[model samples]
Target: MFKALVVEKNEADGKTSAAVQELSEDQLPEAEVTVAVEYSTVNYKDGLCIGPGGGLVRKYPHVPGIDFAGTVETSADDRYKPGDKVVLTGWRVGEAHWGGYAQKARVKADWLVPLPDGLDTRQAMAVGTAGFTAMLAVMALEDHGLTTGHGPVLVTGAAGGVGSVAVAILAALGHEVAGVTGRPETEDYLKGLGASRIVPREEIAETVKRPLESETWAGCVDAVGGPMLARVLGQMKYGSSVAAVGLAGGADLPATVIPFLLRGVNLLGIDSVMQPYDNRVRAWKRIAEVLPMDKLDSMVHPATLEDLPQLGRDILKGQVKGRVVVDLNG
Candidate 1:
């Protein structure tokens, strides 16, 4: 039997609760690969999965962990073999199937990617889905002509996981990075991640009265949507693009089309969950290549399976910072 974080529903109350329990290997869903999960990371979706159904977990008695890094112990698919180091991020594994919250995980071979060079399982979990998505956002921005020496690049929610990693990577690439955050306490943290300037959340959190503001940002990786994103759209420099990664603030985009029409601003939607495997591999490679190991180390907030219950609640309340890497072996 292996230890796993299980969320079971109470039929009496129609509510869900999570706990770490021993589960037999045979209880894991049959799949192409069996992984001895070394490390997993908590994501925003994990908060929902650990607490309640959140419409993401269609079934109860669920193991919720959206990203994990481990070694394959067994494989039925030719694409993978025992002893292969692997990382998994999406394909709805945590929500729709048994995930990496356990010491052992069984998943489809197509969902696994060979762990990139220069990164160990622990480092990969530190990058997690949040960092992976941040890399994707950066790649999208670069694909749209974002480059160094182009006015400052903006990263909203800069103190958070995705925002923090984006700030670090963007700064490493020689772009002047401006991080936006509500908490003044994170100013030093953001600067530590290489943000040259800090934009107060209140500065851009409100809906702008004007359709087009001063063309400021050359590029942006927006993790907080809603009014903040709507406001940022108007501030983007002409022909610039914003990679919309998450809707932590709000999903409804209350903004004007003037930015698109007059400024040629592109709002690129970044979906890491359904990204093509080839692109996923490409992004992971880019992350391992460009993202500084020291900086990645700075962003880690370590936790264990037992810490997940409260950590999940904290994440949903926007109380967690950087990345929360769960040490399954701990």
Candidate 2:
């Protein structure tokens, strides 16, 4: 038996209470591999799965963590074996099947990736979905040929998980990072993550009267997708691309097509979940090599499984500071 944060719905009322409950090995879903899950972290998806806002959970007694790292304990497939370290993310495993919130997780072999060098299980959870999404955005921009001389790179939601790592990676790769956040208090914090300057969320939130404004960003890793994303589109440089990762502000994108037709701006959508295995492997490997650990450390804090309830509430209220690493055995 092992302990896991189990969310059961009040069938009569549709509310959820995520309580730590003891579970047997058979309780886990059927898959080709059984993992001794070491660490899992809360992402925005996890917050929703734990609470009501996200509309992701379709059943009661669900496990909500979307990302985890662990060691293989048993495998029916030849691709992996016992004692091998592995990482699991995306794949709708948390939403459609059992996920990584417990001491054990059985996942499809196709959903697993060999943990890249330089990142242990705990550190992999430190990177989690947030940092991995950040890496995908960075790769999308770099693949679009964005360079240091292309001008200042803008990162929205700069103080959050994805923003923090995106800033660090872009800066580490030689581009000047302009971080956007509503929290003025995190200015020094953002700079310490290699952001060269801070742009108030208001500065980016303000809408442009004209369809196309003076080109400001060479490329952008935009995490907030509302009017903020809509506004940023008008200010993008010619032929520049924006990797849209999250919709923290809202999902409704009120944008004009002028930026695309006139400036040749590209709106590239990035989805970490349901990502192909090869892409997932490449992104993780890139994250291991390019993400500045010291900078990433500055963007992280330690949490425990017991703390998930309150932490879930905090993230929904926009009070979370950075990546939260959950030490399961602690």
Candidate 3:
């Protein structure tokens, strides 16, 4: 038996509750690879899965960890073997199927990537799905001609997971980074992660008044969609791109097409889930290569399985800071 955080729905009222329960391997969903999960992380999605379904969790009695790092205990696929370290994110594991909120997980071999050479399971979990998406956003921006000498790269929702990692990676890549956060208290924290400037959320969170603001940011890693994204679109430097990673603020994009038409601003949608295997490997490898261990370490706050329910609530409320690494063995 293994310990897993199980969320069960009350059939009568449709309310849900989560608790750590001892579960047998027979309860695990059948798949090609069985992983001895070492560490997982609390994401915004986790908050929803641990509480109400958030339209992401497909069923009750669910294990909600969207990303994990671990060692392969068994594998039916030829690509992986016993003791191989692997990292998993996306592919809807935590939402659509059983996830990594346990001491063990069974998943398709294709959903797994070999842990990058420089990272251990614990550190990889520190990066988690958030950091992985940050790397992909940076790659997309660079592919679209973003460079160090250009104006500062903007990271929206900058104190949150995706924004935090984006700031660190962009700074480490020798670009000036401006982090947008509602919290004034995190200015020091943002600077510690190499953000050169802190843009107050109020400055950019307003709805787009004019379709063209002064072209300020050379590029952007946008986690907050809705009006904030619409505002940022008008602020992007000419011929630059904005990698749209998440919609923490809201899903709607309220803006005109003037930036796209006149300034050549590009809005690149970044989907961490269902990303192809090759790009997943590329993003992880890039993360291992460029993202500083010290910065990543600074962003971590440790937790355990028992702490997930509260952490889940904290994340949904935007009360969680940096990243919360859940130590399964702890």
- Estimate, for each residue in 199-316, the C-alpha lDDT of model 2 and write its tens digit: 9998778666788889999999999999999999999999999999999988888889999999999999999988888899999999888888888788778988788888888888
Model 3, 1-113: lDDT tens digits are 99999999999999999999999999999999999999999999999999997999877889999999999999999999999999999999899989999999999999999
Ranking of candidates on lDDT, top first: 3, 1, 2
* Predicted structure 2, TM vs. truth: 0.98
Off by over 4 Å in 3: none
Question: Model 3 Cα RMSD, Å?
Answer: 0.6
Candidate 2 error regions (>4 Å)? none
In terms of TM-score, which candidate is stronger, 1 or 2? Answer: 1
Please report, in order, the local distance difference test score of every candidate based on alpha carbons.
0.94, 0.89, 0.94
Q: What's every prediction's RMSD, in angstroms?
A: 0.6, 1.0, 0.6
State the local distance difference test value for candidate 3.
0.94
Collision pairs in model 3: none
For model 1, how does the per-residue alpha-carbon lDDT over 1-330 read when each residue is reduced to its tens digit? 989999999989988899999999999999889999999998999999999868999888899999899999999999999999999999998999889899999999999999999999999989999999999999999999998887999999999989999999999899999999999999999999999999999988999689999999999999999999999999999999999999999999999999999989999999999899999999999999999999999989889999999999999999999998999999
Point out the higher-scoring one by TM-score: 2 or 3. 3
